[model samples]
Target: MFFLKDLPTRQMLQTYHERYPGMNAEAVAEALRLLRRGSLLMRALEAYFTAHTLSQTRFLVLIVIDREPGQEGLLASAIADRLDISRPVVTETVKALVQAGLLGSVPAPGDGRAKRLTLTLAGRAVLADLLPGYFALIADFMAREGDGTA
Candidate 1:
């Protein structure tokens, strides 16, 4: 199933097992290596969010809210605007985070129909704890990718 090249990328090489006898183990090994790197990325991102009492989407919503133009944040609808996703998506994400105490919502005080968002202190602490592991996984990933040391 390889394209362009005679050999598959490490990730692709993993698909073949019993059919190809005498296949290069090196290819399989390299695929394993790349898979590990990919896994590290997910683990890092996941750990960063989870440690902060957030899911991946919730962390993204927080980042968007924190960096919004006013630095004061936005309504659930406005957060949806920043997300490039649907209103319902933002609504759901915010609802869960609010329940977890990682996020809070206050009325816009202007629109009356809108709710703004903020992160709680416990949420910040969780983010702080997660950052180091995230950084380490990233460093490990970059080291493996940028150099042939692995």
Candidate 2:
């Protein structure tokens, strides 16, 4: 969330360069512009996820499972690791997903205490329904970037 709507002006950055030796005004300005664009993209994604009744993490969890080599799913631990998030966070989200009938857990083979998480029919349908809008959002954003509007 780079929330600085008004990025520093070139003149301001040039003034900063005078006060701070070795400061690159052009580089700094370019970096800020990139950050602002990234922030815009993230905000768009956040809004999209919210409309879908999901957070970024929740969306990612579903993606991680869907992207696995087989239609078969991964363990909660594996998902957490892949997402670089904590176990409890993954567990909590998974619990909610399961409760919503979007996910299912079965006892892990050869590991009675562990569970493997899989997408339910509803989950697959949700992804099928949701991805077009998601991809379109991405394409729209990238198109704007390509047009130098970002």
Candidate 3:
């Protein structure tokens, strides 16, 4: 996360530019603002997920499976590959979901050692309950990008 909540002022960057020849103050300032905004938006999403009783990782895992078509599910490794999160984190999240009765797992047909992960009925129920609000939140965030409200 971008920890610096307040971006450096243009004047400050310009002053620094005198010391560092290559410092493009305007470009750097714009980039910093963009990063700060992105961080804020990420925090908003995390807050929304937390309010709905899900962590970002858990929510991602659910959505990845939900987006897949058919009764057959996806493998844990496949999930790890599809997401930016690490394998160990994904594995732990899947385990927690399974224990919570929000996810189900079955052995792959050809590969008995690999498990195919799918959403349980409770998982679908949770997604169905939360997705509408989630979409609205995302829509609002995206809308700000075009209107300069962000």
Tell me, by TM-score, which candidate is best.
3
lDDT of 2: 0.88
Error of 2 at 52 (Å): 1.8
- Clash pairs detected, candidate 1: none
The true-versus-predicted C-alpha distance at residue 94 of model 2, in Å, is: 1.2
lDDT of 1 by residue, 8-99 (tens): 56555545544576678686666655666566567667776666556667777877765656646677876777777888888898898888
lDDT of 3 by residue, 51-139 (tens): 98898889889999999888798999989988998889988999999999999998899987899899999999999988898889889
Each model's lDDT comes to: 0.69, 0.88, 0.87
Ranking by TM-score: 3, 2, 1
Q: Evaluate candidate 1 by giving its C-alpha RMSD to the native, one decimal.
A: 7.5
List RMSD in Å for every model shown.
7.5, 2.0, 2.1
Q: State in Å the error of residue 55, model 3.
A: 1.0
Off by over 4 Å in 1: 1-40, 47-53, 69-71, 147-150
10 residues in a row with least lDDT, candidate 1: 1-10
- Model 2 segments beyond 4 Å from truth? 145-150
Q: What value does the lDDT take at residue 20 in candidate 3? A: 100
**lDDT at 121 for candidate 2?**
92
Estimate the TM-score of every prediction: 0.60, 0.88, 0.88
